[model samples]
Target: MPGYELINNSEKKAVNEIFDNKELFYNGKRVKKFEKEFARYIGSKYAVAVSSGTAAIKIALKCLGIKAGDEVITQSFTFIATLEAIVDVGATPIVINVDDSLNMDVKELEKHITKKTKAIIPVHMLGVAAEMSKINKIAKKFKIPVVDDNCEALGAKWGKDKLGIQSDICTWSFDNGKTITTGEGGMITTNNKDLSMLFREYRDHGHQNNPKFPRGRDTHRIYGFNFRTTEINAAIGIEQLKKLNFIVRENKKRYNIYKKELLKIKHLKLRRIPKANIPLCDCIIFSIDDLNKIKKILIELSKKNIITKNVPDAIEWHFAKYWDHIFKEQKISKQQLETKFLKSSYYLERSIAIPIFVKEELKQTTKKARELSQIIKSFV
Candidate 1:
């Protein structure tokens, strides 16, 4: 249920207005406006727009001064971008296994923490929140900062509050395949004024934006790189943000249809969700012990022109077990990677993640869910 499905003239007008203003990158008008609205929406004191989610994570790491020899812990069930960002920052990624929720297992989290562990990133994969309360408590005990990788769970909630705001720092993605889209962009949200100012400066090549002078005479607080996003993307993001509630509501309706039907199959176990969490509902995942049945259901869904989100369809990119080719220096062999994440593998290998669409009618969604359940029933 991405925001792209509900694209309308409002987005077009926003983009046109950007061009009509004749100030694309200099003024930071649309970017500022989008950042303000997004901060208000997420209940954060500040929001910084960046080139991508990876950049957001890297910036967070940079702001915290995480470097070589420092250890950053994340779950094995996340997109490789999280690992890549940690590696790019010269920090070693200590990947832990996920629980039934397909998120960072808090029980296993502290076992791997060492004196070098500087940051812990609990990724909310596929529109569900991680056990933030537990994760935060552990981080507090160790005095390690928590960075919630909320790229996939933008509109999700843990308890009554938004998922991202619970942690020390949260990073978000507005890429095309998310709850909302800015074609390709990201954001970093935090309540710390100093951290927010540092993020803003770092993303723009350390431009302090001194009021006394122009861009050419801008002052710098530190050496930085360019990770700035355009006003065009921010303009579209504003429009897309307006439709987020509608998308989430529609997604829940469709998700519940699948949930109700899938529950009829006694053998199929829905992915474990925390009682306090209300997921984004854009994707539904369920695990079946029989690998053969899982494969057959995927084949059947394909025949019906239905596509899965990420569990079995795009697992190579999402799961870290297949990323040994890139982590040679970290001594992560493919076999070792597989063995280390066996717990995560059990759920991921036997799961099917079906995507929910906002544009589809509820009746059609119900029919599809029934058909999907029937397909699973046949396999069972």
Candidate 2:
């Protein structure tokens, strides 16, 4: 359900405005406006735009002073960028298994906590929100910060509020495949003023943005890096932000068509969604208890030219169990990695995630869902 599908004159006009001014660099006009709009939309005090979601995570970690010897805990089912950012900050990534919800298993969270544990990242994988209340409670008990990775679950909700605004620091991706697309960009949101300022400076190479001085004479508080986004990306994002509600609405309609049909098939367990979660409806996933049946369903789907989302198709990249090459650098053996993520493997292997397109016709979606159900029913 990428916003790229809805790209039209609105986005073209926004980009054109940037070209009209001939100011492509993000000198806090378009980028700052996008940040303000996004923060207001999510009900957060502040937002910092960055180069990409990976950069957002890295900047948040840096703002919190996470460094060597410190461990950051995240779910095994998350994208590798989560782990990559932790490692990039010179920290150890402590991966924990996900439960039926395909999110961090809160029950196993405390077991991984230690003196070195500096941050806990609970990723709202796919379209559903993780058990944020439970995860946040656990993190509070350990006195560790929580970085909500709402990259894949943008526009999703936990209880009454939006996903990213409820954590110590939240990160989002506006990449090509995301709910909204900016070609490639990211955002970090937080209520803490100090952390917000740090994120702003850290992403801009430590520039304090002093009103009295020019960019050449801007003072620095600490060493930073360039993670800035161009005005074109931000301008497109501003237009995309206006269409968020429409995207979510259409996604829900199509997702429900699939869900309604799938529910009629006995023994096909849908991915476990927590009661508090109001998903973005961008994707629907279900697990088949029989591995052979799962394979057959996939074959049938392939025959129809329908593609599954990340679950089985891109599991190798999304699941940490297959990241032995990365763990090898930390002296962790392949066997150890597999053993740690056994439960995650069990749930993810049997699952099939279908992408929901915002522009797809409902009748077509219903026809496909019925076809999909029949294929699964035949296997059962």
Candidate 3:
């Protein structure tokens, strides 16, 4: 299998510096610096660092006053964290279908809005930006806020604006697999001062003034959780931020290479992205009537040490069997807004994520992807 590695010694040196200083905590100066750097990077007024992407979403929901019985509409075809964050904030997740690009279907979003609807979390799936202009217009008509789940799309843009700048609250992830890595960290960006302050408090355990003091000693402004990002992680993030533009450019280059090579095949279908947007990952998906055949081919590739696996399934259906009781109680319904829900079906058994990272690896991976596409087309 082609190897994939997410770390470089250059990043390790930054993390080492923080550890040398013993600034392992997530409070005070280190966190502030990371937040400022990230905010500037995304062109947002404020950025709050959190332990994970889920924490960032939960904090955003809490700041927005999303509570139990409240409904938050989001794409069905996303990571479970997107829906889980809604549930974490005591709001019901109303799953909406996605377009061909694997983003929330803006036209169908209006159907899900109701008296109980509180917000819309548009996820930029597989690094592709959602149709934010239309989604924002729909949210405005209902007077609901938008929490952009841009976990997969850190450097992605919509028109001239960046992802987080266009929404009320935009959350990003820096997990090991993301475009950028901070080991494990997330960021919440917003222009709303009140929301930004609330998020800071929420991430640090709801302390009013002195976060160091015991719970009852200081003012307990609100109920909160310990979702702060560590200084070590922040340091790693600081370095990661420096390389983000380079990483995004590399990912895009790899995407184009795959697109150029694979488009020649008749049966394979690549994910579509607008020329203006920057994709987060090169996720190539296609349709196949026989899933077992695809699996067999992937296994054969695995023997050669080429890692091939299906794309992830939609959060709703993946968890349906386990969470059916809660889903039924909440009255969550599924909507299909595309000719084929390729997002879910592609994830089920047919699609695979080809290796794409650095320029050198990307070249090799792109060549392999085209070769694999030919292998699959032969079956067709």
- Write one digit per residue (lDDT tens) for candidate 2, span 1-380: 66999899999998988788888765669888999999999999999999999999999999999998999999999999999999999999999999999999999999999999999999999988889888889888889999998999989987898888778999999999999999999999999999999998999899999889998999998989999888999999999999999998999999889999999898899999989889998999999888888998899989988899897888899999888877866888889988888898889989999999988888889988988888889898
Model 3 RMSD in Å is 4.1
| Model 2 weakest 10-residue run by lDDT | 19-28
Model 1, global lDDT: 0.91
Clashing pairs in 3: 1-305, 1-306
- TM for every model, in the order presented, reads 0.98, 0.99, 0.85
Q: Give the higher-lDDT candidate: 1 or 3.
A: 1
How far off is residue 223 in model 1, in Å? 1.0
Query: In terms of lDDT, which candidate is stronger, 2 or 3?
Result: 2
- In model 3, where do residues sit more than 4 Å from their true spots? 1-6, 210-220, 274-276, 286-328, 331-352, 359-363
User: Which ranking of candidates, highest lDDT first?
Assistant: 2, 1, 3
lDDT of each: 0.91, 0.91, 0.73
In model 2, what lDDT does residue 84 have? 95
Q: Please write out the lDDT profile of model 1 over residues 268-308, one tens digit for every residue.
A: 99988888899999989998999988888888889988888
Error of 1 at 258 (Å): 0.9
Q: For model 3, where is the 10-residue window of minimal lDDT?
A: 312-321
Tell me which of candidates 2 and 3 scores higher on TM-score.
2
